[model samples]
Target: MFNESKKAMTAISQYCGNRVDYVQGGGGNTSYKFNDKLMAIKASGYTLADVQPEQGYVTVDYSKISRKYDEISKKMDIDVEAETLLINLDCVELLHGMKDLRPSVEVGFHSYLQKAVIHTHSVYSNLLCCSDEGRDNAKSIFENSKYGYIYIPFISPGYTLSIRVKDEVIAYKAENGKMPDLIFMESHGMIASNDDYETAIEIHETANQMMIDYFNSVEFPKAIIKKTSKGFSSKTEMINKFIVDFSADENYFDTVNIYPDQIVYLQNNLGKTILIDKDNASIEYIMSEKQAQTLEEVLLGVVYIITEIKRNELSLKLLCKEGEDFIRNWESEKYRASLVND
Candidate 1:
């Protein structure tokens, strides 16, 4: 039995570590209930690669956290009950090893989960959460599927996200006669559950592959350059010249593959562009006519320059690489197609 649990932990680590889109850093977490009294969960700030059967994880008393929270909430006002429960239960100590390690901010949500749980920030999934088209695409993808899922709009992570999920699960169970098997957070990723560890992982894998297959069928426009100048100019010449003069490197002068929304921005007049920052503040950028070339060039250049300038970096090389990757494998294009077909 001990060996089986260790193998399960190892398998969970391998699954999460292999997918860059699912977890780049220590961004997601997994857990399994050992029994009614105990649970084993991935430790905080440690990459899945670092997790083994013996290192940097915790076997906490599940009943303790639940019981303490229940007791504290009863004595506290409703408005402050959750907060009081978290502190009084000593939830912070549940994170084993590394005294400084903080339990996952989503612990509250995890506490209410069943036997096994898997949370991920998969790129394809989160992209679907970012816009209306993506949301609808997700709904249709799982509409009649055997694995039931719940979708929640954008909400802050940690306490707020947990509360929202808990409330949604309760309402869903009341209306549908069952709790969701999976949960999708808008602009975030997903949480899946099953009574068995392997089953939970399989469910996540099945859903992930379905999404990948859907994206592979999408057709994005190939990068093409055409020159209207009546002088001695070829398509390649125009494209090369455009890259040399505008971009940081000629090698990076690739294609201008824009999504529907990006096309709108590219076709807009050349001048200052408005963008929203992480803090929700508006920022403006002034672009010269030289900066905006062919529609594709404009699209690539604008994105490259924006990221570069924001990071105060010397070059936009990485930004260009990201754009190339997006054109080659972007799920947004598939999502856009899904919307049109719907």
Candidate 2:
């Protein structure tokens, strides 16, 4: 029954995976819904680039998720007891071919979306999401956009964001007469979903193009580099606080926590880069001098992105404690990280 789905999904995954401009650090998830009963989602820590139609995804009973969210949604918006509310369900794995394989943490939102959904953390999308006028700019294009669009404020990927998306989707449909084809998540990524696989990919491409064009139409302040303490350089003072001299023995990145993708890429090369460690990561470093230099460039990119984030005065998403937990404990991501380009 899902033969076409497998073919479609495989085609789209491979198509998008091959583009580093779209799926970096395996930080995206794609899924194809097979009836309300099931969906095959890209497994956690797995790159869409490496996904084979039959071997990579975890089949999940998405209907079960909808039911659970419906029940929880009623009281979820209640602010008073939000902290005390308890809603727990057993580990529901109706069919995960590989026992250890977990679907993307984003599965919750995908289940609430269309039959086909592609979510990617493209740098182009971030140009709008992270710019000072990004939301306004994106909203302007969406106003005249050929496709129906929905914009979500920055909410990290989790049940909370999923529930929010579900609610917004319902509201959008009620007002616009159809579900959104393009859902732009602030400071995160964009989701392109449709009943047709090819259209989903098309919409993602189109939306990103719109964003790229929008950014091109506007001028951005260049990231100016100035000498800083301990042989570091940056455009922002807050971010510069974490960087220090390259150390042969100490992990300087330990004192700071950066974005999710940065954590993944810099894990092994912490020591060699002009260190700007944060969040007291305290993880061990294992990269050689060359690896450290390469990672330094990545960190510099991070610093520039972060500077833009601050310059926009946008509260872009950053990896929190929970996100840090996943990068450290998840073995699958560790392997993916070993190969992911920044």
Best model per TM-score: 2
Error of 1 at 62 (Å): 3.3
* Candidate 1, backbone clash total: 0
Residue-by-residue lDDT tens digits, candidate 1, 1-342: 456766676777677765555653345677767667666666654556666776645555656655554554466455343463344235543433423343444556776777788888664554455444555677778888887888886654444556678788889888888867888875457887877778888888888777656544222122233333321211223333334444523122223322222332322322223221222211222332222222333333333323322333222112233433433443323332222212
- TM values, all candidates: 0.57, 0.68
Please report, in order, the local distance difference test score of every candidate based on alpha carbons: 0.52, 0.63
Top candidate, metric lDDT: 2
| Candidate 2, poorest ten consecutive residues by summed lDDT | 80-89
RMSD of each: 14.8, 8.2
272 in model 2: Cα distance from truth in Å?
A: 7.5
